[model samples]
Target chain A: MWERNPVIFLLLATAVIMVGTIVTMVLPFAYVNTERDAIASVVPYSALELAGRDVYIKEGCNNCHTQTVRPLVAEVIRYGDYSKSGEFVHDRPHLWGSRRTGPDLARIGGNYPDQWHYDHMREPAAMAPGTNMPPYDFLDNRDVDPELTRRKMEVLGFPYSDEEIQALAGKTDMDAMVAYLQKLGSDIPWREQQRVTLVGELVNPFAGDPAAIVEGRELYERNCAACHGSGLSGGFAADLTALNYPEEIFFRIIHDGIQPLRMPGFATLGNERLWKIVSYMDSEQVAP
Target chain B: MERPAYNYDIVKHFVHWSILWGAVSVLVGVVISFQLVMPQLNFGEYLSYGRLRPVHTNAGIFGFAVGGFFALFYYMVQRLCRVPIWSNGLARFQLWLFNIVIVLSAVTLLLGFSQSKEYHEMEWPIDILITVLWVAFTINILMTIFKRREAQMYISLWFMMAALIGVAVLFVVNGLSVPVTLFKSYSAFAGTNDANVQWWYGHNAVAMVLTVPPLAVFYYFLPKSTGVPIYSHRLGIVAFWSLIFMYLWTGAHHLLWTPIPDWVQTLAMAFSIMLIAPSWGSVINGYLSMNGQWHQMRDNYLVKFFILAITFYGLQTLQGPLQAVRSFSGFIHYTEWVPGHVHMGTMGWITLLICGAFYYLAPRLYGRELYSIPLANLHFWLVLMGQLIYSVSMWIAGVVQASMWHSLNDDGSLTYTFMESVLAMYPYWWIRGLGGVVYLLGIGVFVYNIAMTARGAQASPGAAAQA
Candidate 1:
């Protein structure tokens, strides 16, 4: 026998670990189940949609398109809603693919016309200037007969009949993928939310005009002094004077939107509203 | 001097065969790198990047590195303990079975049967075979340790024991599965729990099997080749225990910024940062052991490789923990920086140490002089330069790609599309291909040197073999 000393230790430790493993909850301690939300308009994939899904898998399209939406400011601004567990209920293998070689396709549904997606896939650079994605010209009519697509569907376990194929819309290579794409982000209700608010309501400008030194100090003291410091010392993001960005850069960012980052472009605010915020920012000078 | 009888036959056999597989690994690695640069190099399905990747990894880790370690361990253990192996028959069986396992792993992976886990890509059946093989080998080594005639256990023995037990626990736990079919299986643990365990096993697989075992060889061989005892055995023990304690908790560092619990990820990140202490402990120990004996680095080809290997290990460990932090992980986790980190361990640390150990063992084990030390030194420089070029270029490529992807225009949209970032990596990929060719050339030289050495000349009676 190999000396019993460590064997005893192993046995005791194994028992403790085995018991801990069994009793320690195999599921993550922080899980919050979110699969039960309801969707009024969503429906399960029709037979034709199922065929399109098969095409998606066979083409290795999952390598490029991601389905999952990360919970970040940029993701929400760029891709619409953050992914919820309920969005994946109908998916059998859950195509929340990891790599973003192309773009997120969770909400690509109806985002573009069928021909655009078709021509894009066939020769990606034809549509986008700097694309490295290999052209899927193999899916063109010359390479793939309509009959072969039917045969390929059989291997993928879709029980589609010729009659169903005859009834499909937009008869081309793009039609199949677009059918899958059109369903991407159609589930979220916030897609049509239309609201616009004034900039002055959100940002305070106590100082009358930014060019007027006395007025600028008054605005700076009231609105920006506490966080930026009385002299506009470094706050969380950066000291205001430290920013060497051009006036146009600040104007565009303050009014427009930056996706995936917390920095929202200020495009929603008017030109005069952004100038007021800039004026107050220029007036504060930190001692350092 | 009362010379202890060493089992040279098995050592000779393992060293010879390992050099063969080492060539295969480097050759495959070179071809794969070429395929990335020129897609025309890819022959359809069987030879694509998808299939060749596992072959490169398995050949490097299991076929070459592990085989070299096996040969060295067998040789070192017998002499260190002042006794014969507890079971030569078991070890011989292990050597044969080990080759079978590597061959099977290579063939099956090429045939497109994979579990799809990064390093542990072998399917369920092969995983079981590996587990059984490891268990048998572990039993034999532990039994030999049990029967040792030496009074006090050396620090190398402590590392050997940790590797045996650590790998057993890690391999078994991470490999737990519910098989759906012959080659397919779902992890028994699901979701973030699964990711946690997988990385836990994944990163520590580097530690226990790749990291500690090679350090054991370095610590033993460095002093032994120079005929000097270690500078401080007690320091080596401290490094060993600290490494064991910290390594397990650092696995979830890979899952930073993901859905895994904030606390778990933070804990792993913290432990990974703390890991630098133990890692450098061994590095410092290796260098300090070389005090006033730096002259050997010039005359002794084996010491050159050994010293350089430890230096690389020190750099690799420092880089690894820094990358594990959340801020840095955000930039590099899924990028070319990731592969750069891995190859440093594989090409720089593990390969260099194995080369030194093999060169030292070949002459004594085979009772012949090394055919050429100049050729061995030549091999060392080529591989060293090649690996450095490969890793550095990839690291720069990954950082540039990541920063581009994360960059935003003032208008709040991404400055570069995903395609533009990928386009930037092609030149780096081509450079990496060139670097791999250089490394493969080095392996070719090494294999030739070993083959000629085995058949070359006899040593004088009772004389130590020359490098």
Candidate 2:
């Protein structure tokens, strides 16, 4: 019975399987376990962003959207700079998905305003025609559970204060999702930030002029309001009312929009109408 | 020697339940395939593609494939060893545990309680249930092997041992995590490390679960079906050892061209290329075993499945290694090509072989001849057409998608935006979804054949024949 023991066969098989396991898995883990490379710019999610990420995970967005940008020449051009390994250090269960049914979201942060994400999620087909993403309008009706968010942050080992955790209370999944989307890749200065060609005379030519404001409203409604929202808040574009910027920055952006993000330039309107729209935007409330 | 009264009832029930699960998995697959094209098909929260995609995978892998593994392993172990199952009680317990875990897995996944690791998505509580079930299975099978009357173990036994040991190790090591709530947990590793560990588990889940068990079933049933012993048991042993050795290293291939360390990717790619040899080793063994039995392909419907399944196994291994190559991976890593590759293995190689196994076992267990060979033939044609259509269309889609993504204008700006790349997939998605419908129809025929055999057949293979 002892001759050519099956235990020996079992042992041999176990040994063979372990050799690869140790080499591929165990060694790298031991050596690189200490020196992690979370890039200098990367940081942990705040309370509401973490809550949004939880909603993202719960909805299984990773099934369709990948978070990592590959280091390919074309890919870099398509979705901004390639994703860095260090940027994902705070990711516990890493959402670097294997498929790309949708676009990569590694650099989605600061790419659009809060309102764009909200409208896009609520009605994806209306926002982008010829796409098949199911609408997520139900998120507006549901609020984040603060206790659960607190427990999740603790579980993920993220640092959060009570105040930060409390900020999630009464916030809808839409709000949290928007916050997370806007926070995503904010660490990096992507194309949208770098492309603004600031020239002199930043002030709007029609600043505080009532007649220009009225004319600007018509141009803004015709050209920008569909994307920028009728309230000058936002839709498919950034929330213009949130930030304060001079007219030259606005002039350049309006005349030469960020094409890669699919934002079109309205240089067709000419300088006068463009500045009138800028004046109209400048006169509007910057903060809700 | 008197027969040990090999238990057929356990094998019978396991086969029956597995076929049901397999049907559920296929039905869900068809629905989700359409959901990708016509997003309107995605109904409510629980029925959407995101929630049900995991349901499709889990039901297929665990509910269908793993259930099939249990059934086939029990059947093969007893006959190959010339001994009855070591503990009928353990086997009975395992049958229930196996099913409950699958049900709980489907429900939990549909509820969106996922840890989000591909292939290993079940959270901590369900994970513990799987561990208990695995432990019970391991103990029973090992005990059966230990007490076998036969001295020289068959090659299927070798493959079986490798699967048993390999899955236990892979599942446990990868499942290491710190649980926050009963329903949730965080991987012990993070970011790059988490990715490295996941594919190590993820890809090897293919090796141990998908490849090995089906190979074990194939080796057992092929010779049984063809009425000829395998050409070389020695080749099977060598292949089994080498195949087990190499497969574990190739998991990192999934991480190729990504953020993980470069050397790991190279090592994974090399091992992946080398893996074709051992995978083909069994394929060659199966082909050469048919040396005198070439006429069986005409007379025997079973031979059609075995030959084609092994042929697919050959093709799948070849495709897998080519995909692992750096340039090829860069082009099609996240494209539809990967899904196409995976389904060829699952639908073509694994499911075909196991369906053949079930057909072979159903008659013997039910004590009756198969209800209809024509329906079996119908299933064979339908599934083959379905798999071919699915894989071929997706392969075309992957190439087209990759080209469009890589396409650049002469001035060097992107020629197509991400949305444009998505728009190009519509035609192929429709074709792929149609293919899924064909595959599901084939599985429906399969389930009907097996179910009718249970109800229609009265003649039984006695306890003493093979026993």
* Poorest stretch of ten by lDDT in candidate 2 chain A: A189-198
Candidate with maximal lDDT: 2
Chain A superposition TM-score, candidate 1: 0.51
DockQ of each model vs. true complex: 0.06, 0.37
lDDT per residue for candidate 2 within A89-176, as digits (tens), equals 7777788898999988887786555566777898887556668899888789888889977887887778989998777778998899
Q: How do the residues B127-209 of candidate 2 rate in per-residue lDDT, one tens digit apiece?
A: 88999999999898889999998898777887788888889888887788888778878788877888888888999999999
State which candidate has the highest DockQ. 2
Q: Enumerate residue pairs that collide in model 2.
A: B367-B459, B367-B460
Off by over 4 Å in 2: A1-4, A31-36, A189-226, A229-288, B458-467
lDDT of 1 by residue, B314-336 (tens): 99999999988888776665567
What clash count goes with each model?
17, 2
